[model samples]
Each structure stands twice: as C-alpha cells, then as structure tokens.
Target: MKEELIVKAYEVAKERYAAIGMDTDKAMDALQKVQLSLHCWQADDVTGFESAGELTGGIQATGNYPGKARNIEELRQDVLKAASYIPGNHRLNLHEIYGDFGGQFVDRDQVEPKHFESWMQWAAEHNMKLDFNSTSFSHPKSGSLSLSNPDKSIRDFWIEHTKRCRAIAEEMGKRQGDPCIMNLWIHDGSKDITVNRMKYREILKNSLDEIFATEYKNMKDCVESKVFGIGLESYTVGSSDFYTAYGASHNKIVTLDTGHFHPTESVADKLSSLLLFIPEVMLHVSRPVRWDSDHVTIMNDDTLDLCKEIVRCDALDRVHIGLDYFDASINRIGAYVIGSRATQKCMLQALLEPLDTLRKYEANDQGFERLALLEEAKSLPWNAVWDMFCLKNNVPVGEEFIAEVEKYEAEVTSKRN
Candidate 1:
C-alpha cells in the first residue's frame, strides 16, 4: 500500500518538475554518481587503534554514547551497518591512528603500508575505496607545535610521520584502484599571540615541501587549514590564506572543512574563487553550532547554499565531498545515517533546481522573475523525487529508516555496554 503511494507521489512530482523544464530522472542520475567519503572516526569518537591518546589537536567529541566500536572489527561492523541504509556506494575515510596495530604500539614515524594490509583486504571485500588523513593530535609529541615547531628534532618527527602516511595512502589507492586523498592537517599554533609568525609559517612551508617531495601515482595530496583551534586561538600556522596560496603554487588539492571557517564566513562563496586556481577541492562537511564544534550536518540553509553553489558553478565533479563530524552524545550509527542522508537530501534539492531557467532569467535581466523562481523553488516536490530515489536505490524511502536505526540500537549497540 505504501509502495503505491510512493509511486503515485513520484508520478505527480515527475509532472511538476517537467513543467519547469526539469527532468527528475536526470537529476537522480547525477546524484547517483556522487560518492561521499564517510569518516571512520565517528564510529569510535576519534579514538584510533594505534594509541590510547586523549582526543586533542584542539578538537573534542562531546558525548558518552554507549556501544561505540571497541575494536577494528567492531568499527568495521558499525560502518557496514550505517552504509546499508544509505543509498549508493560510498568510500570510507580513515585516520592514520586507525591502523591495524595488532595490539602493538607503532609510533607514527615507524608506521608502514603493511599495517593497513587488512584494511585493504576489508575494503576489497566490501567494494569500497578509502581516503586518509595524517593525524597530528593527541600524541605526547604534539604540544603547541609539530610540523611548524622551532625544534628540529620534534619537527622532523612529524615530517616523517606525514611522509609515511602518504605511502600508506598510495598502497590503499593502488589496491582499491582509485586515488586515495591524503589530507595533512596539523595542530601547530599558539594559544596566546606570537611575535614570530613569519618564522613559523616559513618553516611550515619548508616542511610541507619536504614531506611532499616523494610523488606517488595512486595517492593525491590535500592541505587543510583552520581559522583557530581550542587552545590555538590567537594564531594558526596553516591559515586558509597560507594553504590556498600553497595549493595554487604547488598544484595540490586544498581541503575546506566547513567548521574550520568563522561563523560569518560563507564556504559557498569560496568555491568559485578556489575553482579558478586549485586543481580540485575536498570538502570536510560538518555543521558548526557556534565555533568549530564539528556538529553533525543537517539540511540547513548553510548546507543547502553550499551544495547549490557547487552545482550552480558546474563544479560538482571538481569537488570531492566527505563527512567530518563526530557526535558521541547520540546513537553513533543514527548520527551517521542522519548526517549522511541530510547531506544527500541537500544535494538532491540542489540537483532539482531549475538552473537553466534561472540562468535564462539572469541573462535576460529579469530580476523579479529570477528572485521569485528562486523563492518558489523551495515548495517544489523535491521530497517526492527523493522518495523515488530511495525507492530506486532499494533503501528505506524516508522516515522508515528511523525504525531500522532504533531496532539496531535496541538489538545491537545497546548490548555492547
């Protein structure tokens, strides 16, 4: 009975979209090609298998949700469970600390590709690609500085760690037959004001050049910058300006974490500008309540605008999308499903936009028509089309997934504690 109603809703929606010179089928096809890289840290609150280090690097996941993955196998199981409800094939993003250490403490600099052999096998079995990040936080060596440290010995340690991470990403990419995007984000900055800003920035540039010296075929490099971290408030060594300039000069991808920018700043506004220079852009999608809280993403105005601009700029293919929020206060798997689906819904809404007609209105100088159509677009039956999408993908067609998540929690995660 519900299936008939869904098909009926879609038929009416198909006709409504067709009236605006839009094709629902085409929009769904475009969306189906997009693959979001789901971060692995969400399953375990950023506690990786490599160490028992406290979550640092100016980030915090504030929740004590039970049933968090306690081991590699458990994390993998939770990830698979979350992915089952989400439509389409998506990749998993792995932190350097999540390696299979086999209960042995392996320092970052001493890590190698062999440590992730099981991950490669696991990804191959699941038919998913992997993305990676070089973790520089929560370690004893990570004080106020790492790559940008004035101390050569400490700086060299981090440099070697990042270099080894790139090799590991290359191996994962080769095994998966896709380029692994390795993001380099350091926790190198000062809490109070610093006088030697240029000195630190120069040192960071040099360290990046050395770390990126070895070129690998299967791995791609991206540099992420932050506005400020919890303790590192006054000054950040790798500011957005620094990485933007660095990426353009070095021909590398620049990562834009939504929560990394100030609240007043609009990430959507930066895409067109960055697309003009950078090779490609990687998005670490997260919703920031006030500061860089890394709150789970929802279908809000900011996200809608961001995804809409990506489609409007005709740069969807040029931008790599990934989720980067962890909330331990709620059911971990439920958080994954909500955030991932919210992002997809936003993307779908953007895809369903009558872009051609709006562009024509702009070209013809029909200001009121453009504004009116833009406003009216919100009322379109995009939700119906979204239901159709979920139906076609064989996933739950809306609110239905809520029950599945609750069922999993009651039967599985609730028992973990």
Candidate 2:
C-alpha cells in the first residue's frame, strides 16, 4: 500500500515538473530521492515542523498530504496515527514532530512557556522520546562566553536552561507518567585554541557538572562523541568519558549513535568496551549518507549485521534504540516506514546469524531449549519477540536483559584473563 502511494506520488510529481517545462532529469532525481527515502528501512517518517500557518504553506508547496489537514488538531491526529503505524521498538527522532509544539531553538526570552508545556504533553501522550547529539541545547550566551574567562551570567544561563528542562519534565510527569527524557549535547569547547585546551576541558566539565547536578540529576545522560572535525573536536565525552561520568554521577550512561565514531573504529569492540563501563546505553540508529550523523537513509546490511551481533551479545536490553533523523523534506509516514524496516531488518539479521544460538545459550544461563515457544523464539516475528521480551522481562525495549549480558561479558573476560 505504501509503495503504491509512493509510486503514485512520484508519477504525479514527474507530470507536474514536465508541465512546468522543468528539467525532467532533475524532477526524476528528486522523485527517486523521495522514493529512496520512503523505502529506506532506518528512516524515521516524520512531518510537521511548521505552525498551522507554515503547515498551510507547506501543503501548498508540496501539494501533498498536509493539504488534507485543515487545522492544528487535524495535523496532530495525523501525526499520532503516523506514530501508531510505526513499529513499537523503532527509535523516533522528535525534532520535526515537536518543532510546532514549542521546542524550537529560539532565544530563551522568546520561548513561550505554555507552548513548551503543550509540546511535553504531546510527546508523553505519543510515547515518543527525544535524543540530541550536540545541537540539542541553545543559549544566548554561546557567542559571549569564553572558556578562558567564563562569565557568571553564562553559568547562570546554563543553570536556568537546566531548571526549565526539569520543569518541563515535571510537567510531562504530571500529564503523562514519566519525566522528560532528554539527550544533552554541549558544544562548550573552542576550535581555534591549542595552548589553553586543558582549561577549556576543565571549564566544559565544570559547566556540565553544574548542569547535570541541578537539572538532570534524575534524567539519563547519553554522552555522544562528535568526530566531524580533525580530532579532539570537543570535550572527552564519548563512551570513555561516559565511564568517568557514570562512575561519578548517578542516572547517567552513554547513548551511542553508530555513525559518530571514525569509520575505522570497530563498532562491536566499542559496544563491548562500553558495556564494561556503563550498564546501559541508548542508541540512535541511522545510516550515514555522506559521512553525516543523522541521515534518514536506509540501513545497509553491514549495519544490520552489527546490530545482530549486539543482540546476540544481549546488549539490546541495555540500549534504548531510536530512529534519529533531522531531515525536514520527508513526510512522517515515510519516516515511520524507514524506522520500522530498519528495526525489522536488524532483528531478522540477529535471528538468522549463526552466533545467535551460542548467544542464546549464554543468555539463558543454561543449555538450548526444547519447548515450542523457545524454538519459535528464534523465528517469531521481530516485533512479536521484542514485545514478549518487554513483557517477560518487565523492562522496556532496549533495556531488557542488559544486566545478564554485562555479567556474562565480565565472566568471559575474567576467564580469558
């Protein structure tokens, strides 16, 4: 059904472009790009990064589904229905969806408190979570604050941001059941300096300590690495940095996005090493389109294979998986399809992997199974198996069986040593 819709949309786009005397090749290329994005398994199909007015403009511009949604309520309903169609275990990026809900990166003074509250409520009701890399937080003091002589006002600004986050969490808790689960990304270092780099590091740490101590005392902190630049782009806050932070602070862990590391970095080894440091980690699952972190592209087989290894190692229980994307062009339905397919493909890879049997043996703490359910567990549809794991283990997806996996790894490492 989705494929048919995509095909029809492509044909209509082609005809419109031809009628306008536009370049057929460019139109076909755009159509193919949209189709590819739609078909991609790891993409999070999301829409509505605009207000009711902007959405009206988008509807006219795209001549797409947004035309059907006349009002804000209608758009909200459309987003909810789109979320429902997406897989339960799939990780969703909230940037596009919640932009209209009042979580924009505008100046602190301009933020409408009521709009922010409405946004938090919407997220809770949808059961969707937000994850940020480094672009998550914005501050007016960013341009003014120097790491060498950090201003008191800069510190105060960060503190206020933290307080606002906590207030939002509390609001969400009041409306929903849990506090706001936010991913903190701080770009607190300078790129031009080399002599006083250590000072910058200390300042960044102190700032984060203050932020975490006050606002995120109870929230999960996923420390992600930014490797876009040559080297040492920011503070030491990747998996290794997370170890120190987790050792020092409570309710903290690493959120590992697969693309953040150097291409040469061994992902399997990285995952195993992180397990030794922190008991849990969150995952942002996306394929790199041109060496980018959050491309809403299809998951390749190699990525699926690695995900399989992680599952075979029983790391899913420790990692919360989310579909992380920031592209505004793709529709919400497309995002859902991509995320669902990525998750499904990854699960299928895990089940079919030869290592799965051995991993199961290690996970169950005993020999292989004989029951029909046990036999079917290997081939039971990915969604069904994940649901059972959620129910049987009493933990949400990506958090089930993490302790056991870490324990097994410890034992294995101990014996090897």
The candidate that wins on TM-score is: 1
Worst 10 residues of 2 by lDDT: 32-41
- C-alpha lDDT (0 to 100) for residue 349 of candidate 2: 37
Tens-digit lDDT track for model 1 on 1-417? 988999999999999999998899999999999999999999999999987667887888897989999899999999999999898899999999999999999999999999999999999999899999998999988988999998999999999999999999999999898999999999789999899999999999999999999999999999999988888899999999999999999999999999999899999999999999988999999998877558999999989999999999999889999999999999999899899999999999999999999999999999999999999999999999999899999999898988998998888888889
Which pairs of residues have clashing backbones in candidate 1? none
Candidate 2 has an lDDT of 0.44
lDDT of 2 at 276: 70
* Candidate 1 to truth, TM: 0.99
Error of 1 at 337 (Å): 0.6
TM-score of each: 0.99, 0.58
lDDT of 1: 0.93
Per-residue lDDT value at 59 in model 2:
13
